[model samples]
Target: MAPFTPFFSEGLYQNMRRVCSESEESIHYCSFPQVEGERNERIEQSVARMMTIIDLARNIRERHNKPLKSPLREMIVVHPDVNFLDDIAGKLKEYVLEELNVRSLIPCNDALKYASLRAEPEFSVLGKRLGKSMGVVAKEVKAMSQIDILEFEKAGEVTIASHCLKLSDIKVVREFKCPDGLTDKEVDAAGDGDVLVILDLRLDESLYEAGVAREVVNRIQKLRKKTGLEPTDAVEVYFESLDEDKSISQQVMNSQELYIRDAIGSPLLSSTLMPPHAVILGEESFHDISKLSFTIYLARPALVFKSDAILLLYGGNTKSVHGLETYLLSRDHSNLKSEFQLGDGKITVDAIEGFPARNVVLGEHVFLTVGDSVLRTKGL
Candidate 1:
């Protein structure tokens, strides 16, 4: 990163220095980074296979008009041995499940239910040896059944149409059987050369509503980007929907509150009310999920004065007070941009119940209890 920092951005280099607390201004002064351990070939191969599954699954979802926010029922994998998919699932299941938003992965050695393997001659390989007879052998291989293919896979050879065929002389291809109601018109199939992946396109009510929740998360994530919020800058999120979308939005908030909160990095401020300073998205931003539409609002938390003494009160009561800092700037500083601080206790908060709350704040997070109401600047 240091080598390319100068080419990328000077601000990035400055940020790296500030964040890493590097005394040296230039990273050219630091030692080059290096790998620390021996590479595990098995794990590397597994990860590659995992990536292939995710890529294929995503493509399947997109092609079938299935939105990424909505998760599907399952991923159907067809391989000669179930262990092929099971082995990959053992380590990388979470990556596939989360990335594809699928509920489960089902590995099958039996492809008869939804698919079957079709054997074909490796034309160039078998051509030289079989000569003119290759045409007849290719036809016979195409007509072979699932049982024949399974047996041939084990023995690596079998006599087909009274002609001897070896594993090296043929190629195996898995063809979809097309479940009921689904036509064989479109393949709806993807592969990574070794295994076949078919996504279950069947969607239920629960999954659709869950997708609505994810859509809400997606919107807030967009808002965070639109507002230029830092990754670690936790902003309170709010949402409001029209008369028709109100129930849907509330359902999303009620059911998927945890999911939305974790995704947005903030507790939902309110699902019913939109704040005065709330920035609302127009029709352009609403990528409606199942005819449901909603607007998300974002407000970066504000700490009135210094956040040090949130327990401070101006209600003429004696209480515990710390090094509370307040700024009294010039009358020209109405915009609160560039000012000189003159603390005369001008700002006051009379009604706020204090409680401890440790939050992830700033680039390098520090755990501290800043009162909740104090953070919203409710009284101010």
Candidate 2:
């Protein structure tokens, strides 16, 4: 029990005892698991830095009361070490964007440039190191400029009163008050001397569209939970926009159509847009997101398959009887068929009728479903 106590949980021990028939009936009898590899300090440091960046973003979000689902326009990150900042930014740029609900991330040189910084000397470190000069050093440190303080933080040492001091020697704090040139629009930021994150709350048309897309996903997830649908089950989705000044309906269809399809496991199966008043399948609901209203419809589980055909070749140089016969032999030559005259012979293409087909809808637009076996749509 003592040997396995560190690695094995009670549940894991019970499971092991039940499953491993050939081994001893107790986890205590088993050997401890071996370590697989050596630790990489650089990678660990990079990850730690990334976590700090994420924490900074989270703090800003909390201060501004911005929900994680509500996507923001941008996040400005300022760090004293350019190389370290770039390493974290380049390595985990996408992760930051996703976790922070931000569209763009801009890395700046000194985050304190936008703020008024004051230096507060650490009495303990300064007193022990400088002794008699501590009082004089504190006065000098308090008078240092933001640039000098930043340099002190970055270099881990500063010259004050002819005495040298390092990071262990000082503490830098960002006050909540905004500095000059920062309007009421900007938010208060929190960070150590090393890193800072500030979020831009303003939203443009594209950002608004992205937010709506997130809402669509959220609503679909809620519907899935309410209806008790399996994760893989595909549901036909229908929606109508309430915003009039901008084309919310069109934006949802054009920008988020593919994402909506894949996320909910339901591709838009309709050949045409469903009218606003059209009766949508399954449990329906209404949502007001970012001051935009949407009437959403989710259809029952459907495994419907769609089919299409193309004329690979039109032989006989437009004048051959065989070409005409080939065109006539093609299946389902209804209103959907296309006819092209090449030379004298004609080529025809049509979608096969009577096959199980999918017709899904998103708002006022419908995706053309034409594939075999498993259905697929255009890339997002």
Candidate 3:
């Protein structure tokens, strides 16, 4: 963005002085005309010429090579009948930068269409490289109108408020409070033109991707008739962490599992590459460990597919390993105990309770067992 320059700056003043001098010369020439009728005609002609010169000068200044110097930038010329000037300006401002990168500015409207026709092949090639088909590219251009609506919402106000219509298959799991005199039923009603505001609240991973909050807004709109007379208004949906205890990675893992189950006919745990581990207990398993030492066990044999085999398990503290000797002695897994001691390894555990596993990818046949329970296995 360029710094603002005053209208009466040196360069502008010089241009204005030139324009005034040209106008004065024209007026003087007109005054000296010989015939009375000719003088009047000369005066009229001079005024018209002066006006044209001024208009040309103004156009040059407006479209000058200099950078933008004011927050109140360019004036858009549109048909006089267009009623939504503010709405259009607001939407445009949302997407267009104050100082656009040279390559970012593309012709719109008539100019865009003309350019597209002339560069059709090149456009097609570029679109294909970007993973979009020519038809899709054209469709996107046509969809600009709908996109503008979203832009308007984002730019016009910091908080979005709108009534939403519920989809038939969707359901509301919670009641969101609103100040627009809307009831639960009203918010849940199924209808068109229902307004709901989307607050810029940080959401849990699951809710964020699933658009649960947006669904709530739609439900509210649907339930309007049942609640009472519906009011046309917008509500802000603020971000609230739904699962604040869990880390982002843990939420992502859960979401991945859910997606797999819903779309691929198998849960993430059910996949052959990484099956869930089974836990088994023996009669003497509880008594073998020292109070201060704990055994780390794996159910399946370790298979190193990659250079490293890392398993991240969360939820434990120093106290967790304190009672291990007694617990192991009770369990009578002496062989397991011997193997754990021979590994000469480190015990890694978190001090707090939260989602602990992160970036854990297992290789083939690597089965991790804890306390006779298979913690995880390669290939479900």
Q: Tell how far residue 272 is off in model 1, in angstroms.
A: 4.6
Which of 1 and 3 is ahead in lDDT? 1
| Model 2 C-alpha lDDT versus the unseen true structure | 0.60
lDDT of the candidates, in the order given? 0.61, 0.60, 0.28
Off by over 4 Å in 3: 1-178, 181-183, 186-205, 208-268, 274-334, 345-367, 370-380
State the local distance difference test value for candidate 1. 0.61
Candidate 3 Cα lDDT to native: 0.28
Q: Which ten residues in a row have the lowest lDDT in candidate 3?
A: 282-291
**Backbone-clash count (model 3):** 67
Worst window of 10 by summed lDDT in candidate 2: 363-372
- Residue-pair clashes per prediction, in order, are 0, 7, 67
Residues 1-380 of candidate 1: C-alpha lDDT, one tens digit per residue: 88966767656666777767635676556567798999988677667777777888888877777878887877877766545567766767777788889898877767567676777788888888788787888898888887888889888899866778887777877766677777533336776435678887777777877787777777777777877777786556666675563766677667776776667665565644432323343212464556776556665443323233233332222232222222211112332222112222132322223422222122112111122432344442
The TM-score values for the models, in the order shown, are 0.64, 0.63, 0.15
Ranking the candidates on lDDT from highest down gives: 1, 2, 3
